[model samples]
Target: MTDASISHLQVLDWGLLIYDDALKLQEALVSERIAELSPDRLILVEHPPVVTIGRSGSLDDLRESEEAINRKGASVFHVDRGGMATFHGPGQLVAYPIVKLQTKDLRLYLQMLLETVAAVLRSYGLASEFRGRNPGVWAGAAKIASVGVACRRWVTYHGIALNVNADLRWFESINPCGDPDGKVTSMERELGQSVDMAEVKDRFTRAFCRIFGYATPPEVRQRPTERPSWLVLSPSCTESIDRMESVLSWLRLSTVCQSARCPNLGECFARGTATFMILGTICTRTCRFCAVDKGKPDAVDGGEPERIAQAVQLLRLKHAVITSVTRDDLPDGGAEHFVRTVEKVRECCPDVSVEVLVPDFRGSLKALQRICDIRPDVFNHNVETVKRLYPIVRPKARYQRSLGILEYAGKHGLIVKSGIMLGLGETEQEILEAITDLRRTGCSFLTLGQYLAPSKEHFPVSRYVSPAEFEEWAQIARSEGFKKVAAGPLVRSSYRAGEMVCSMRQPLKSYQSKG
Candidate 1:
């Protein structure tokens, strides 16, 4: 065959085949293409849990012995790829592109593969970027999809493995691609929803066609309709919501429940408890999932604290939860605003326990120290989703930095609390890992909630978590040595801050004791 590019690509969907079987099929297809008997082919398949070491990999990367590995219902195989050890399983999506190269430039071909996967993720509202030397798409600190390929007779095989909804626990058995520091993340854990494998396959297929310049468009996969159960407000809740709105309007204060477009706003407001956003309504950051207005925010209002205090006093709130939009523009990240608000609330109603849900303060120790020094009843920050989704969902935030904020407050004997949203496409393993990370930060009170899309323009909802799952995680968190665990569909960081403070007055277990 001459070195001419083909006009069309043949994509074969081989569902759940073993590694050896898929390898044989790839060989046959490559031979067919070499002989110019068949068009170039793309093989999409799922392998029943196995670890594959590439040509450049060493045995040191595999942690488990061959016998022990078999006992766990898995196997290790050597492949002809160019990377180190990596695992593949049922939930992960694997694609082998056996296309004849146009110019025999293997490096360029590999880069195109990464771009193709990144493009597919982008369409699903996931933002991934190519690192300088890394051969994968990164969602922040975590590697979501990795590429390892080989070119034989100018045809490519052994493409990319995207962790769509895989259990990340399998990766703990080895240093994936020989990188121990960078963690692995999945679509399910990041998006807080279960993804349909067929749908992901279709999306990848379309992206593959477009990137490789296929003349014909592939079949478009219909997106499954999202059905978030409509929450009904009780009559009492309606009356309370009205009262909460009037008080908030009277004071000209804002609540995150309103600005962030929380689904449980009515219930929280009606219950006379609202997570007040102390700073202006406009946020400095553009988190894709948040509905809070993003722009140059209004200057810090000197009288904002007094109005917030008045709102708390008028509502007779036993606990006042205050949070602010991240103000990267500020010198102290609005730390003074937080401190002054807490002080005003305490002065107005001494009985009101204050919980401050704060930002990372851009990892400034002085800013963190200032918030900690205030001695609020509870110092809270959300690790948000798992570390993997930070770039896609929260582009400007750092996962470890957020943890450090909690650790700093926890070490100071503050009642540290944190929360994460479910159905952001986070795997069960990632959720457990995030909780463990939070627990290490001296966080005892945990809140886990379902993430609802504020609007069509915002990040799409990936999954709706069941009430049972929330209860299950709450029980898991409590059993894991947490002092108080609030896990439910509608649970927010400060929605039940008062009850948590009133019912559980004990200090959190120290980081050392948590072990």
Candidate 2:
């Protein structure tokens, strides 16, 4: 296995893809796995209609000619797998495991694949068994899943495909596994009802991991729902997280990092950096996009600023980031509380630079001026999303009012900053327009991050913005005049806050042009 230790396996969902493209991606990941540049990964995807022939099969196995298959909208391929002939199409769940082999026995690996599929079927109240002579999972007399694989450099690809709710008619065209009398079935056919594809994938992932001995530690919480492998966090710093949480609890303080469920919590906590949240965790505004609790807030704790300042001193942070939940109930929209916190933090650590991601102050220029007057090193207010998505994403937060907050801070000679979340049903043109609008307000720093829905009740993610696209947007933001930009899948408004100042003092590799 290239002499690399086997860590916990990761699961990635590629959604819907074409067969050829998926194969190409598998080859690339296999190379990376062989070179020890990547860990074992399970790639989950669904492909369009197609038929594949394994090394043991020929054109005679096909019931129809190539032209007839094409007319049925199904293409055929000659693959390097060990099976005969099989059909792959929509409504079927395909799992291609890019894994480094721990043993050279291909038979054992195939047995593990069969056991995993059997376990998943058992979870859905369906009994499945593998007939060694048949080489696939069967329910009584009909095949419910297919197993085939290809290997290179001791890494395996082209794994099992389970029939979730696929139309079995496609199987009629090919004598499945070169047996003309073989019967094909699916989960829906066995249960007499369609099953939830998402749930089946979850069960299959857990079963596969358990069967392959890649189980996650009990201490680690499960990864977020349907997150791509890159976005999933395999937290290896539980002691650090426990220590930080304990300290925050002992101090009677709160952090935006915990309240917002930020993906960077483990990384930042391990490094002894956190964004303090003042004015309590409960917010008065009911913004649909935010994860903070919505309700009547608790009474403002007058000593909260001093406690926060103590935290800054104890953490010994060179750059402190403070943010809060929107509190429209307060007359000043909690501006005075923000001012007090900043003052205490500055008094406690004279050398530390401060940044505050504030709300819009309910369009109160006077309250906005109060925060601006403190002149925290950086002043930030996120427009959060494109204007067109405002009503749906943040019904209570006005887009124009947020821009005005940034503009007012910029006009007052403060280093103004703002942020936005992508994957909220916003188009490319809308994103560019949003960036231009922020630039017009003289926003010096910008953060563009992917929006992850916290739960099924929250807004669903329209798409996952890729890393290359984030970099391209960063380049565009720089050309649009944003002095510093942090754009990526896991980036948040206060992510890497210290780096912005450091970049100003010297060159940072993160901001350097890839070109």
Candidate 3:
């Protein structure tokens, strides 16, 4: 027996085989042969009508009993892999690559497999992704490809199954991969057309070669030699510095926080307060008065919640405001992530208070329910400007929808807050109407501030309201029964958010007691 170290072998086009039946035996046979070969090799195989179970599989997922499975001319066997149970049959291409891991990193291998399958599917005009926390090639929310592999002695055994032109009815007989709630679909299901299996196999081979050949082995890099600059300041100064640091750290994580350009960041940081940006940085829709970059956004980061939690802990923040760029990209409008981040922050620092400035979620009641379920201390949604200017100032968002979101939060007993920017070419009557709309929504907190044009390329500012006008608006907002009203040149959403939320609770409680 040649004991050649697997890493020393430079792999080329290895081997391929197709089996029409006995899939479990085929997998076992291939695995045994690859072990005997004991070097780097790629083996492509196709299985006949069969069902395989992974490590997380349950027998209940199968419709037929073990004896019935054999009587039906198919077989069932539990295998070592990650996902649950799934069906393998003729017309589906299953690749069982027996490649030894030189780097011993399973995550990198899984990611590579996902990208390779997605690339192959994309060639056929199919969009796919390995959505975070989901282990497969997904076309939208349906699984097009399933992956389950096991590594023994750092050598992989089981591999992936791409549903090219497979009969999907078999999936109905069982909870495919034991995911009772998940829908099992194929390329045919998505395109409403049959796919050519032979052509798909060819594409898969080419894609595999391209991805594996060029794939760089995972590596661990040394930490940065230089330490980050640490700023020391007085108790007041420390708060401001910490707040800025939290926001900066959040931005570095590639999530969205509207670069608020609030003049009060310095002061808030001095008080050790920060406004956390959740979801992602890009907005699905553009608003005229805001400085947040608007465009087609990338996918929401699943790790954002944990990072926000870590930021709260790192800053030792007593109060944090979590806000996000509008994410019409998601069905939930990123409300789930917002709730998750809030929950995580509360878990990390139970004493700290959390405020969520959420989007309208396209008036999704389910989305609102998901957020209300979290029971954040405050729920804020900005109207941006008056209803008359809504079309031009906040075109994609409806004025009524914003009101509804705040109303829903209030109805659920959350402290509801909304803000409007002045100097958007609105009349005093329009401003009053907007305030009335907000009050009708049961919003107890109001913030009115001058709208400063972020850039010359952006929407031009119509006018900057004078300090006297802001004061008058504040008075009007108070008269409208807003428990806490802040109107000024520099007030932005989440600016001194803790102070606002803290101040409103007393008056609201008192009002409720009187009633």
Top-scoring candidate (lDDT): 2
Q: Write the per-residue lDDT of candidate 3 for residues 183-230, one digit (tens) a residue.
A: 777777777888886666557656665666533232111111121222
Off by over 4 Å in 3: 1-239, 254-258, 503-515
Cα deviation of 163, candidate 1, in Å: 28
Model 1, range 1-515, lDDT digits (tens) per residue?
21335756766776776777677657756765666655677788888989999988877887777677678878889888889999999899999988888777887887778888888888889889888676888887799998899887887888999999898988888888888765999999889999899999888888777777775564221211445453333344567778888988888888887777666667666555679997798888888777788999888899999999999999887777899999999999999888888878877997777889998889999888878777888889998798766766787999999998899899998889999988765668889999889898889899998887777566655567878889999988987889988887777777666778787554323211110
Worst 10 contiguous positions by lDDT, candidate 3? 219-228
TM-score of each: 0.58, 0.57, 0.51
Q: Scored by CA lDDT, what does every candidate get? A: 0.80, 0.83, 0.70
Question: What local lDDT does model 3 show for residue 377?
Answer: 77
Sequence-dependent TM-score of model 1: 0.58
Q: What is the lDDT of residue 289 in candidate 2?
A: 64
